[model samples]
Target: MSAPWLADAVVLAHLAFILFVMFGGLLVLRWPRLAWLHLPAAAWGVAVEWTGWICPLTPLENALRERAGQQAYGGDFVQHYIMPLIYPDGLTRHTQLVLGALVLLLNVTVYAALWRRRGGRRG
Candidate 1:
């Protein structure tokens, strides 16, 4: 209801979505049948970072915060909250790219392992 509370809610939701996008592949690895859901989400996450497109949720959350009279944060929510805990100074573009690459690499590795296990079962 209040500005700060609304902003906090937005920040929390944004963080949850980021976590889901980053780790959802692990879930898919456990249940390979969910590739249909996880693959698209993973692709979208990668595409958003590669293209420098602001996630729709970011803008919507900011708008809501602004309407609530809270100061809207500029960068991605990860940069605002998560990065500070790990990196003292701040997040740079290079760091963001590295993080994105790590997510992509992790998902790729999981998918490959799953494929091998499935193939072995068939063999």
Candidate 2:
């Protein structure tokens, strides 16, 4: 695929992953085994936000954009794309930490409920 095409694909894939990281808990409600996948993804998402660490995909996407003669965004995926829509003011370190905490809290709440539903048995 052309660099531009591939870059666009990366953006879409990155967005999908972000959505999954944020809301994958609902999936776990249906298939408890999904926790194995959702938990780690949630962790990574939180880590990225709290640490302000650039996910590997960021560089790959940036490189593709550069090759395609597009400007590369500086922040992580959510800050660059999704933040503008949800947090028009933009993402800050404080906001990032909150994002991380939300990920943990949300997942914990969801898992706790799931556990209760399953009678504390691993599914």
Candidate 3:
């Protein structure tokens, strides 16, 4: 595939992963086994936001863009692509912290419910 197309694919995958990180707990509500995957992904997502660490996908996508001879943008994927859509004011440290907290809150709530549903079994 062309570099640009590959870049686009990476962007889509990044977005999907972000969505999964944020809401995958809901999926786990139905498929309990998914927590094995979702927990680590969610932790990594929250860590990225809290620590202001750029996700590896961001660099991969940027490299693909550069390879396509496109003018690669500065900043991480969430700042360049997502922040504009959600927070037009741009991403700040405070914003990142809030986002991290929100992700943790959502996942914790969902997982708690899952735990309850499973009768709080230890296995």
Candidate 4:
């Protein structure tokens, strides 16, 4: 594969992972039985960001890009793609923490709402 092709694949995979991290709970909400699967994935996603850990996917993408002679990015995939759109300046520790917290808070709120709905039906 060419360098550009590898870069594009990495970009797509990164985007998909982000979507899964951010909204996997929405899938769980739709299929309540999958809560077990989604919860862990959501937790892993939050933990990865909070700990400043590079997701396995990021490295895999970088490796593929390198094989194709593309220049791999230094930071996380989010910093390469999403940050520029959201922040004109750059990513900071505070912004990273806030993003991680927001992901946790959103999932928590979604689960709470689902629990309340389930409880209402029992009553």
Question: How do the candidates rank by TM-score, highest first?
Answer: 3, 2, 4, 1
Candidates ranked, most accurate by lDDT first: 3, 2, 4, 1
TM-score of each: 0.82, 0.93, 0.97, 0.86
Candidate 1 Cα RMSD (Å): 2.5
The alpha-carbon lDDT assigned to residue 52 of candidate 3 equals: 94
lDDT string, candidate 3, 1-123, tens digits: 999999999999999999999999999999999999999999999999999999999889989999999988888999999999999999999999999999999999999999999999887
RMSD of each: 2.5, 1.8, 1.1, 2.4
Q: How many collisions per candidate?
A: 0, 0, 0, 0
Model 4 weakest 10-residue run by lDDT: 114-123
Error of 4 at 26 (Å): 1.9
Query: How does model 4 score by TM-score?
Result: 0.86
Q: Give the TM-score of candidate 3.
A: 0.97
| lDDT to native, each model | 0.78, 0.91, 0.95, 0.82
CA lDDT, candidate 3, residue 37 = 98
The model with the greatest TM-score is 3
Clashes of 4: 0
Instruction: Give candidate 1's total backbone clashes.
Output: 0
lDDT of 2 at 85: 92
